[model samples]
Target chain A: MRNLIDVTDLSVAEIDELIATAEDMIAEPDKYAQVCRGKQLATLFFEPSTRTRLSFESAMLSLGGSVLGFSEANSSSTAKGETVGDTVHTVSCYVDIVAMRHPKEGAPYAAAQYSEVPIINAGDGGHNHPTQTLTDLLTIHREKGRLDNLTVGFCGDLKFGRTVHSLVNALSRQKGINFVFISPEELKMPAYIKENTLDKNGLSYEETASLEEAMPKLDILYMTRVQKERFFNEADYIRLKDTYVLDPEKLETAKKDLCILHPLPRVNEISIAVDSDPRACYWKQVKNGKFIRMALIMKLLELQL
Target chain B: MKIDSIQDGVVLDHIKAGKSMDIYKYLHLDKLDCSVAIIKNVRSGRLGKKDIIKIDSPMEVDLDVLGYIDPDITVNIIRNGVRVEKKHLALPEKLVNVIHCKNPRCITTAESQLPAIFLLSDAQKRSYRCAYCEAEKTRRV
Candidate 1:
């Protein structure tokens, strides 16, 4: 009966259950491979995102379910000027569940408002991507063996990183967790998040520009890309972005067990040299993305559809 | 300091002076059958200026129109010449089947028959983003 539009939509217990279900799926993959057999996942992505779009498909396929819908706005009735509500209502008839990504904020919520089937917000502009938060959660649970008591560092772009905002909103709820916000001034976490979520929760976090200084004490380093488009001035982007790259040299200062996580298609926020360090969990994060989505698809559709 | 009371009516008070006409146009209050007392340039110790509109019959107040006119205005429901309830009008939870998305190219904005639906994201912020275009709208009347 509920839609997964934001990470806040899933309670702490539900998140734990989702991570636990993902763990079980990982251990016994074949058992859950066909749980969603014959069901279809309609992915209405108004924006082009190969990684996210494919992850949903991979998740559904791994669940023995079929995938339907479009990747781009041009390919869909959106090009013909069909309304999002109409599109979702129409697609809901053909699919048991829906995942929609749009360039506009709240578009998925609008779709969810009318969808007869369960709706998953793949990504809605800069608003949220709850599934990515699920991936981060599963990764944290797998790597750290628990979601609590970890000092997680979010480096690089935080200002406009929906994944960063979603992850922070998700993790700030857990007990004994602390945060190190590593970003340049221009890309610092938005005030709304700091004021609304972190400060309101009374979570312990410090904002800093230096990653190396914060690296040693962290249990998880969640790196997000420093987007060029986010900057109004090219000089600002140039000056601030290069300050937080995580190379092998920087990894030596990090904890031996530090889990490096990124919602991927990363653009050099973490150097390629750090990829083989066994601590790099971004690719593992991607795989976890698929399984977590599989868990979500099963969880959402099983109850309602 | 005397005020007339009406049975089964509404009393809109503390509106900004000179805004009565705007509120009237916004709410389309002219179309209704009830006797309406629209007091303009009224004295107010609190606001330094004010206006009031009294209706002699109960009418459904258009909150969207109210939201557009001035978010600060208050409404009072009167029954049997006694004040029953004083309600502060607010934007509805989800404005569906009303308004039109302004973005001409947006799918929902283009669909003439479909109501322009907008979900109120931040209430205190007094901002309504178009559900289709992701455009932010500020109420000014």
Candidate 2:
């Protein structure tokens, strides 16, 4: 009955458990290879998300579970005027679990209502992508060795980045967390997030425009792209697209062990030169993304450890 | 200016002036075959000017519509030509179909069959968000 529509749906202990399970999966890949044998996963992607869809399929396949379902609305019954509930209800009758991604916000949540099996929200428009947050959390925990008492700086488009919102929400529950948000005034983190999470808990945080100005003090640097899809005006998108480009020069003032992370498909926001730095862990985030999803699939299905 | 009192119906009092029509429309008073009177801009000692709605039938009203439109309003249930219960309204925790989600990216926009559910996200500010999309909507009327 449990469905992950938002990162907040998982508690601190549950998140720790998921991270632990993910770490164990990384350690012993052979142990979980056949855990999901004979089980099926339905990837009900109503949008085209190549990396995310592939990652879910790869994760299920790694668990020896077969994958089925569509990649876009045009290829499915949705194109034939079928509702999401009808499609998911029909798909759930055949599959053991469901992984859904849709362009409209809350489609996955709506699917969970009609689905007989457990539902995992892959990504829902710009609203929520909890699995991405899990990947980020796993990356941070593996790199930093802890999740609390460290300064986390979020850069770039904090406004529309669901990853930033989910991560901030997850991190806010931890003890002694300091947040430094770096973005232009137009792209600052939403006030509701600050008011409801950080300020409500009395957590310390500061806002600045320059990433370099906040770099030296950060323990974890999370960068995000200024998504063109979120902006309605082409002029606004063009003006803010090149706002912050993180290159090697920007990392000169950063700490050596700073865990630099980005949710990828980068278009020059992260310079190619920064890839060689030991602190840059965005690649590892991709690797961890699969394992954590495997753990999440296992957890939601209540499969054996 | 006097209106006949109902025998076994409901009286909505203390509605903020000029908000009676919205409440009437939301409550679907126009569709009712029974007597429904919307008295507007009535002089009040406390509110200065307020609106009242009198329903002649013993039909139930949507409390959420009344609450969201004007929570300051009071409700009186009349039974057998006598006052039965006087109820004061407060902002409801959830609203279903009282208002629609304006966000174009919301799932409710495409699926017209889906119930339009909005949750009271911020009570003090009277802010509601679509249950599906979490799109913030402030009080419109």
Candidate 3:
């Protein structure tokens, strides 16, 4: 594919290939260090995102490639009201690839239409985040050595969590994957997603308000922050923010091999005390994010590792 | 009373009743400098009531959009006041720049230059989704 705009853009085989490539990068990092030598990656972030932007930059740098472009729209020609198409066209002339994060849902898609270079969607407005999905996939592959037959529990904000949606969509394609959605009533998984991704695929899934009850049966626990930004009302945000914090007490009943994952910049969803737990692989997930991005950049650039 | 047949033009027949105005606006029929007639709530054997638009000038119309709005629509071509050819419409596989995506965060909303495209994802449900954001197209704007 010319661009990685959504998780669905990658097929099951391609995801496996990426995971394998990521594993190779982890084992022998030096061999792939200079794969992207003399190349340039433009990071055009229209919104404020520290982790995703940095991870992309780090991925490129580790591959012996250079990084350019703006971290914010106001810092770039976008402040002058330059269109995404125009910006992409201009940036494509200078860079080999682009990793764009925008507040607009399909801004990267619009850019991809005009870009001569490969475009990677770092994040979009509550839309799909394919790279994070990749990161999660790699993490799961490393932790459990398989993507199938796992009872995965998604805790906290499943409604507005783009990561949850992307991961669910990706994982649903795997065989024997059952979803245990743990969230409050107000933050239940959207019907369209349930209908289109899960129900359409004939995937098994169940919903519950209690994370504790779901913990024992879960092979993987994917926790997401209840975003204050997604809430329109302060009262609702306050009420739901602390609904499902993954403390030591909550993790007590979880399986010893239950791999806990989270897309970082987490806002008090997982407690600090649980960080030392063997199952808490979120930190490793972050590192895996960089490795997978490196793999993806290499794949998009058609460089053999 | 019977509406006069156009000598050389197009006839949009079997439009769902009350939807002719939307089609007129969508096609910019008002902007056409030709004789145009809209017959609304006309009795028909196939359809209990329907709307028909007769344009007395030969011009290109977006059949795909017509299909999207109402797949049951029939487009009849008139030549020398004779019904030469008739065409039926079904939902197009993909529609480009036909309707704006309503999602506020959709790329088309931010970049006006980008054509708002929708793909017919669910044929049974007649559901279309924005090609860019994958947001379901609820209505035409």
Candidate 4:
């Protein structure tokens, strides 16, 4: 049961394979349209995430597969105290594959533990979101034409941002991948990610408070919203909230080939003025999410979705 | 209630004074055939509140369950009115194949056939983390 729980679960070879598969899907979308024609994807989104849910459903739909399951937990049997195991046990009988999202960190893993079908972790609280990592990988592969030997800067709430954490962990496995972690001192990348993923793996990464200084040298500038609630005090929020915003002026200092990425729902972190730049690949990142997920659904079920 | 301790039995001690029932429920000792004695709300010079549960027959209890319910439990095997093997309930090396992680988003939580896997990262803190999702939760042992 090769569940997509973490980025590490997919080895370098498997990741390359997934990237290749995604490339194939991109090349020949019509050929693989009806691959999972009779299959159904059960999207058990316990959390309220319209974007991820729509992405998964759209992927299934584009692949000629049917979709079932609830968008919110309140619409499901979970409101009656139905255990995750029981919910999965029942849902597995009805669907060919399952994509689950929940606020509890390990809930999807627990569901996969008892599910008959393969489980895809859509997102698990502040924990790992392997599919999003796959999306980021595909976007990086499509945009940069490679996933190695590049300097990637991760800006804003790196500490608790699951997307940043997952992508950094994924990129750490590749060779000559130097990372620039740009953030306020309070929301720096967590110690475990620094120690376990970077240092333990012998990856070189430098931490800096200045995004503009790190901009020119970066091949990829990944922006994330510095959440207001992460501030312990109001004064700290006012001080650091606008520090990492990537406006047009910042991109002028960056390389022409440098791609700016954001795992969207941006507040002020990414200026609206930067949208016209060909370098802003965040929208492309979202579309790649659908394509990569389309590839993943097909691969997991042995279908061509 | 006076109950005779068998030649071979297990005695649980140092239970928090009023928490004997929780331990009893967690251990499921009441369902067993063994003669069990539970002394509740007992006074101790060391502990402000304490209770005791003595089982008159040898039985194997789920150590993980003990850890989950009350982490401060001490188990002593009695042989011929003498303490033989003292088993201190410690968290398991790898908490796999038990206790379903409460997180619904976890891959382990969604798979029906896979064992509920957990790894006890902190022994002192009784913090068991999910093997797949890495969600930490404290269970008393």
Candidate 5:
């Protein structure tokens, strides 16, 4: 693929290739350290993102490549009414690749149309973050040694969670994957997603309000924070924010080998007391984000392992 | 009474009732120098009531846009007062810049110069989704 705009952009074989490349990077980090030497990566983040932006920069630095570009739109020519197409055209002339994060959905996609180099969407509003999907895939493959035949339960905020949607889109294509959506009625999975991604693919899934009821049967429990920013009213956010907290009491009913994951910068969705649990692989997910990004960068740049 | 047929022009038939005005405005037919007539609420055998637009000059009309607005529309090409060709339409596989994407966070909203593109996702529901952001196109016109 020329660009990483969405999780669906990568085929099943390509995803497996990326996972294999990431595993190779983990085993022999030094061997691939200088693969991107003398190259440049431009990180054009129009929105505020600490983890994604830093991980992209770290990934490039570890590959012996340099990183450049602004962290916010106000600091760049975008403040002067420069369009994303113009910025991408100009920046692609200077950099080998671009990792862009914007508050506008499909900003990187617009940029990709004009960019000569590959465009990696770090996070585009709530549309997609394919790199994070890659990170989750690698983490899952490492934890369970397979990506198929797993009963995965997505807990909390299925309605507005872009990561959940992207991961679900990717996982639905795999064989023997069943989804158990655990969320409040107000935050149920969108109808288009259920109809297009799941139903069209003939995937089996069930929806429920109680996470505890779906816990014992889950092989993987993906937890997401109910963001206050997504709600129009503060009272509604306050009322629904604490609906699905993954505490020790809740974990008691879960499977012994259940892998728990969260795309972090989390606002108390998963309790701090559960951090020491063997199944809590979110911290490892963060580290895997960097490694998988490294693998992706190398793949996009067409560098051999 | 019978409407005068054009010698060499285009005839849009089977338009849903009360929708010819939208098609006329959407196609910018008023800006054309040639004569254009809109026949609204006309009786039809296939439809209870339909609208027809007759243009007295040959010009390229966007069939995809017409399909998006009303897929049941049929376009008849007239030459020398004879019906030369008939064109039937289905929901287009893709549309370019025909409808504005209402999603606030869509890239086309941020980049004004970029054309709004949508792909037909569901034919049964006649649904189109933005090619960039995957937001469903809510506004039909």
Candidate 6:
């Protein structure tokens, strides 16, 4: 049941293979158009997501595969209170693969227990989202030309960001990867991630609250929104909210090739002024998501052009 | 409960239902030369169902290990065809560094200096969670 419940489910070698396929898909789209003819993809999103649902539909459509799914729990049998395992078991009968998103953590993993087809976790509530992790990896590989020997800085709400945790888990498997965690004291990275993923792997990393101080030393800066709710008090939020925002002023100390990345729907975390900068790669990440998903669909279906 | 037909043996009473094997293995009863009888699913007044392990000969048992695994267990020392002494056990409420938390979000995961402490969350379900993060302890089926 080769399900991607977590980013760690795929090895570094497997990720490289997926990346190679994604590159091939990017270079030549027509050659792989009819690879999944007559295949049906079920995008079982228990939570509503415009970009992610569209990404999966677009990827399946690109591969000549049709898509079927409900956009929210209201439209599905789950509205009547069906269990995730039962819904997935029934969906497996009609679809070749399953991509699920839920509001509860570990919902996809629970679905995988009964699903007969391959299960892909689109996103879960503050939990593993391997596809987004794959998108970040594909973008990083394409932008930097290597996954190793680079310093990556993750800024903002590290405690609740599933994307940061997934990326850190994946990157820790690579060689010579140094991590710089930049965030306010309240939003600092969780100890479990630090102990289990980084230190347990014998990886080197340092923590800082100043994104500007870590800017010049970084090869990649992955930015995440720090919601005001993550802070304990208004005083602390006012004191620290602006420190992580990437702006033209912050770029003065950064390297010319410093690739700035952000998981989308930015709310002033990266100033509007920095979008025009040559280093902004968050939009590129959105595009790479489709290609990487295309590669993942083919890899999971075991289809070839 | 009394092993009326036997002489000079030890009796373990009021073990949680189906936990006799844990006690059996903990005491290394498999390699013992004496006859060992493990009674399972025995009816009890306090507990609806329980298990009992009886050693056919007098032997020294580690009460600390037994108490930690199940506090409800009581050991009856039998010698010369008579019950000599009964030892009751009391386990501390918090277990420290005895087991690790399975939760990925637990504080003990990163703070290597902090001890992994777990508290019994559900006695009937036999479930425990980390004291810091309060993640439910998962058991191997």
Error of 1 at B97 (Å): 8.6
Clashing residue pairs for model 1: none
Local accuracy by lDDT, each model: 0.81, 0.90, 0.90, 0.82, 0.91, 0.82
Q: Write the per-residue lDDT of candidate 6 for residues A1-305, one digit (tens) a residue.
A: 48888888888999999999999999999988998889999999988787788999999999999999989989999888677778899999999999998866666766776899999989876666789999999999999999999999999988777789899999999999999999878778887678657876789999998887899999999999765643447897687666677789989999999988987768889999998998999999999999999999998888777
Ten residues in sequence with the least summed lDDT for candidate 3 chain B: B132-141
lDDT of 3 by residue, A166-269 (tens): 99999989999999999999999988899899998888899999887898999999999987777668999999898978889988898888899999888888
Decoy 2 TM-score against native: 0.95
Residue-level lDDT of model 1, residues A122-172, one tens digit each, is 887666789999999999889888999999999988877879988999998
Which ten-residue region of model 1 chain B has the weakest summed lDDT? B103-112
Once fitted onto the true fold, the runs of candidate 3 whose alpha carbons sit more than 4 angstroms away are B1-4, B139-141
Candidate 2 chain A, poorest ten consecutive residues by summed lDDT: A44-53
TM-score of chain B of each: 0.83, 0.93, 0.93, 0.80, 0.94, 0.64
Clash counts for the predictions, in order: 0, 0, 0, 39, 0, 0
- Predicted complex 3: CAPRI docking category: high
**What local lDDT does model 2 show for residue A230?**
83
Q: What value does DockQ give for candidate 4?
A: 0.30
Model 2 residue A236 CA deviation in Å: 2.4
Per-residue lDDT of candidate 5, residues A77-118 (tens digit)? 999999998998999999999999988888888889899999
For each candidate in turn, the TM-score is 0.82, 0.95, 0.96, 0.75, 0.95, 0.72
Minimum summed lDDT over a 10-residue window in model 4 chain A is located at A225-234
lDDT of 2 by residue, B103-132 (tens): 888899989888899999888889988999
B46, model 2: CA deviation in Å? 3.7
